[model samples]
Target: MNALVDVSFFPRAAKPLASYRKFWAARFGTAPFLPMSREEMNQLGWDSCDVVLVTGDAYVDHPSFGMAVIGRMLEAQGFRVGIIAQPDWQSAEPFKALGKPNLFWGVTAGNMDSMINRYTADRKIRTDDAYTPGDIGGKRPDRAALVYSQRCREAFKDVPIILGGIEGSLRRIAHYDYWSDKVRRSIVVDAKCDLLLYGNAERAIVEIAHRLSRREPIEHITDVRGTAFVRRSDDDTRLGWFEIDSTDVDAPGTVESHINPYQTTSEQAAGQGTTCSKEDQTVRPEPVEGQAEASTSSARTDAGSGSKPLRFMPNPALPQRVGKQVLPPRERTVIRLPSYEQVKS
Candidate 1:
């Protein structure tokens, strides 16, 4: 087997956030605090917000708060940003307080995870939430990210919803739910949002917001880093890609060596049945049970020396199970996880 290659897949040089061309709406200037009510918007001489932030915490214009940081950052880009902090999630009416977001609704569970904020370490209900005004409790519901996202969808059926913050970041993948004692599906799957931004999302959020401003379809904006979205199992438009079984990565096991798509044309021609000479061509392995046909061209590293291999862990939707037929090995690829049903069991 070829030794793993160390490559810088991302650029070392990045344009500063301040250097982005301000949105045309930047002519409106900035608000002392993002408008929270229609009256405030009216006072600011605005008709509707470009982006509405639905958050579980009170609107404190501080970097410590996820909603504020994102809202202010978008505001700097000349987008009319509004806040719907701690809205009544029981109904969609409260979500309409900001009217409709022209761009999209940015939803977050506040600075901390909703479950951690609402529950005690011993699984007892907490009496107060520090994020709320006056240490108030019950301001936000449990699983605020998912609940708020659902309400946003109901309020504006056509508007796009983007989920973020601690709750979203933590639950981006299948993980054991301490409260329920079971592995829960990705929050992106549960929220049904257009996108879930995980980790430091400043760059991704800025790019997404700008792209949406340009009237780009949200569905087509999947390549951004720090974001996750669900796609059909058979969408394999990506070229020059391959797969690796998860078992090989997670547990040490003997595996067959396959030709790297990034190898030179002479090297590729030397390998059996592998002929991905051009960047557009891909080496497709035989379809295995529950595996999707997703593929992408070899990624270029920052050094620009060689193609960076793309490896994806088996999605929870496609797990390798006992008693299942063993699939043949594929070259230059990674395994996809089992479906939620299989993993939840």
Candidate 2:
């Protein structure tokens, strides 16, 4: 999470989320709640929203509901934000209900990944949706971020589409799709979204919104930390970061392997150093790193030049507590993960 990391696409925010100049709409004050319908938008004396968030959960104006906090934050920043919650995905008319947004369409799959929310870890269909108002099932499509983004694009072809939330954030890169049993390309590519914001977009959203409001092109706003977008091989980004290719970061050690999918439930639990099995859990967890990634905190790695293996000091508890930290060149550096083509092959 960029909020936790000291470096990335950029360092942690030096500026506060609210410190930015408010948008022109901030003079209207915060809405009773983010407008969800044309009637509500009219009631708020608004013709168009600055940002419209499409979510798969019922509109709840509590801080516990993430979208609520985001809406209020934007409102505090003088942007009129609207919510399109759990709309009928069969058509694009519902998406057009809020009319076109003045800035961009923000899309999410709600509190949980759509596939996990609608199905059990064992891959069985679920009969109820916790996020749905009535606890009714099938309120969202299997891949809600993709569906909502596509529908938003259909509703307003010219408006930029930005995807966030756990679903889009986790899938921002090529990763194993346990549901599909294949490596899927980044969600930005699959959704054809102009940008994908990952891991706590508090800083990224505020910056991007302000820039877009000033008529800056979304395609040119690639420097925002924790956001991902596509670029052709020949595109001259002129980015000033050092990208370390990490494809060879680790050797194929004897112990490196995915846990046996066919193992007894008990065996799987023991291997994970947990007494409880993850299989068929009653409550699904918020998204986290995949279970398949190898742990490197204590693992010795011989940097790929035939040198002796060495253990890296585990990361500090807090990024700010850089107590006795060593130095590397001040060049902004990031790990260049395997390409989508490399992953698929």
Candidate 3:
């Protein structure tokens, strides 16, 4: 009924979630649940879905299921969405059931990582999958995100693929894979998906769907938070990093008990009563670099000299309270890690 909305519609401080105008499909009202097959879609009198979500879990209409949450969320935003859950990955026929989406294909490995779902913590094959309808195992393949992305590409070669869910997000970059017993390259690079949305992607996904509906290219939608994309080899994206040492962070200065430890029970009991004695004291370590002075809040110090820890009572919250914490700027942070080439060698 109204014009479409973009990121700049709302104030910088306010969330633009519900601010976007609803898609024209809002007039179609809601389906009983997101259609799982073309028959269901035909019954709803829909020629094609706006966005089709390909997932490795059964399509439960509950919020607890990742695909359901995403599907309903987009539906609420007025987009005609469909689901292709746990489809037979052997052929692209299942993927084409809902037909090609007008916006893009959202692919996820469901709630849990496929490898974790198919195997136990010890890397033994698992016999059960709680997410599956039958409470059985092997509904989805190992590295389900990669497999599903490839299939989506096969079904609709011109459509953009958006890789998501725990399976893909966890492996966004070169990381160790327990099942394969080795490190693997970034899932986006391997899947060749246009974008990868990580973490709680409600906001990110909503924006992406709307942008795609407006015919914005997914590759150029890189500035959206929570989304990651592979860069062209010619692109010069500079990276910077600063290290935070655990030891340097605020901590209970090391304990140097002035009292003897190998004492008799009688001697220890006697020492407990004399809490005010100066001989029964602890000392503070030198201040951490950049810290103007050592923390004295947890210990009593002599007024005359530098921090002379009279007694040490650790304050667990010291780390949060003392440091000049600097959060990396959003949309510009770059993590530095060893290249897969070096790590493999």
- The C-alpha lDDT values of all candidates are 0.79, 0.80, 0.78
Q: Which run of 10 residues does model 1 get worst, by summed lDDT?
A: 1-10
Q: Model 1, 1-345: lDDT tens per residue?
A: 111111112333545788889898899888888999999999999999999999999988888787888888898988999999999988999999989899999999899999999998899999999999999898999999999999999999899999889899889766789988899888887888888888888988898899999999887775565677766545552233344434454642335787687878766665656555574366567666444333222223343665567875654655454553453433323345455665688
Which scores higher on TM-score, 1 or 3? 1
Which portions of model 3 miss their true places by more than 4 Å?
1-14, 235-337
Please report the candidate that would top TM-score against the real structure: 2
lDDT of candidate 2 vs native?
0.80
Clashes within 3 Å, all models in order: 18, 1, 0
> Could you say which candidate leads in lDDT?
2
How close to the true structure is residue 272 of candidate 3, measured as C-alpha lDDT? 71
lDDT string for model 3 (1-345, tens) is 111111211222424789988999998898898998889999988999999999999889998899998899899999999999899999999899988899999999999999888888888889888989889899999889999999999999999999899987788767887777888777877898888888888888998888888888775675666666776433443233222333444445555757687886557756677444455445657677556454553233555456555665666665544465565553344334445575566
Better of 2 and 3 by lDDT: 2
